[model samples]
Target: MPDNREARAAARTDMIMRTTLALAQETGYAKLSIEAVAARAGVGKHTIYRRWPSKGLLFLDSLLSLNEPALDYPDTGDVMADLRRQIYAAVDLLTGPQWGPLYQALVGEAQHDPAVAAGLGERFIRPQTDKTVARLRAAQEQGQVAPGFDLDLAMSILSGPLYFRFLISQEPLTRDYVDRVLDALFAGMGPRGPADAPASA
Candidate 1:
């Protein structure tokens, strides 16, 4: 496979995406334009349009390319440890300031753009969230979690506090904060043993 042409095209695409992310980081999405992206990317106007028909499509693709690979569920012979690792991996990505603004803009845009909303749900949310639920289910099968624990509800509990910290309180997202949330969640949902017996008379 000595196709020089394909390799060059791929490199150009990568350059465009890198340049687009840099611009989007410097300026809000509302100010993004094809011309600006072309200038930043060092590509011709026709080159940009040849691939993406609209700014929304280009922006969506650019944002998606920035995501890290989904964290695979680890089987460390201990459910609690595995879950803590998985949840924290997600939290780390969300708290990174470079990508946080992009996520915020995407969420805000999803409120009005059905196309972007659907794309987000399919491409990013489903893949990552499904892994989380699967990990929880594996733990449940091993009796490490309560049999009646609602998987969806449980994930929400694990993530809800972190989201509130970042999106509501606007506080610094720190490991200590994540640890506290995980502790409270585990207290509520982790395994339960037999209740203590009544005291002797």
Candidate 2:
């Protein structure tokens, strides 16, 4: 009986999250509400409230549940290649129709709401940044990256431009742009040899 109860709870949670995403996709985040989610999910408002404290958090959880797998970093031993692959996959997901607008809405909300901003940093940004740093550490161990390089700074440098284009400049995030960023990053961060030494003036 206990096992059955747990299974039922899990199923209901899954259904509620999926319903939330579907409604957000159709009506957008600005129009999404707990009442709508509860009605569409066939659950009491209290049920969603018990699971999530706010609409922003509920939407954040739903977005991560659906899209986290696609954003995972690869470990192909070639750090640059792996980073390239993972970043391209991320760009595709972020710019795609399913979650892009929803994420944009969340980011907009985060600007005005401290709770949403904190949740975004803690739940999404920090985890992704940690994963990136881990990958860079692995490359450092393998001598692909400089021993003394700041992995955290490298992560920011790598992601900063993309976010700038994504959120600020509103420019297209193309593969060429990704390649250029990687090229520039690796040029400075990759293992250096005598040939890489700067020429005397």
Candidate 3:
């Protein structure tokens, strides 16, 4: 009986999240409301409220559920290749008609709402950052990356420009842009040679 209850709850939550995404895609974040989602999902608004404290968090979870598979890092032993593949996949998603605008709206909302910002960081940003740092650390351990630089900072450096272009500057974000960023990052982070070392400074 307990197992059955849990299954039903999980099914309901999935339905709610899917409904949220569908509504957000159709009506957009600015116009979407918990009441609408509750009505569409055939659940009480309290059910969503119990799961997610705010609309921002609910939307965040919904987007994550849909995009997690595409955003996951691939471990192919070639760190640069793996990173490139994952980043390209992200670019595709971020540039897609459905997710791109919704994510942009969420980011805008998070700017003024601390709860949303915190939720975004805790639920989405940190996990991605941790995965990136882990991958970089693995490369460092395998001698593919130079030692002594902070992997956490390295992860930020890798992602910073992309976000800047995507969200801030509103510049073109393309695979070529990703490749250039990777080229610069790897050139600096790759194992240094004696000749490449700094002379007496």
How would you encode candidate 1's per-residue C-alpha lDDT over 1-201 as one tens digit per residue?
848999999898888877777888888888878899898778898998899776766777788876655678798978778877876776677767777888777766777888888877787877878887888898889987888999899888877787787777888878777778877877878877766335579
Which run of 10 residues does model 1 get worst, by summed lDDT? 191-200
lDDT, candidate 2, 174-196, per-residue tens: 88999999999999899988888
Residue pairs that clash (backbone atoms under 3 angstroms), model 3: none
In candidate 3, what are the lDDT values of residues 1-201, reduced to their tens digit? 569889999899899999999999998899999999999999999989998988888988888776674467888899999999989988888888987888888788889888888877887788888889998999899888999878987898899999999899999899999999999999889998899978996
Structural RMSD, model 3: 2.4
User: Quick one: best lDDT, which candidate?
Assistant: 2
Q: Which stretches of candidate 2 lie above 4 Å from their native place?
A: 1-4, 198-201
- TM-score of candidate 1 against the unseen true structure: 0.83
- Between candidates 1 and 2, the one scoring higher on lDDT is 2
Local error of candidate 2 at residue 118 (angstroms): 3.4
Model 2 lDDT-worst window of ten: 63-72
- Give the local distance difference test score of model 1: 0.79
Error of 3 at 50 (Å): 3.7
TM per candidate comes to 0.83, 0.86, 0.85
Highest-scoring model, TM-score: 2
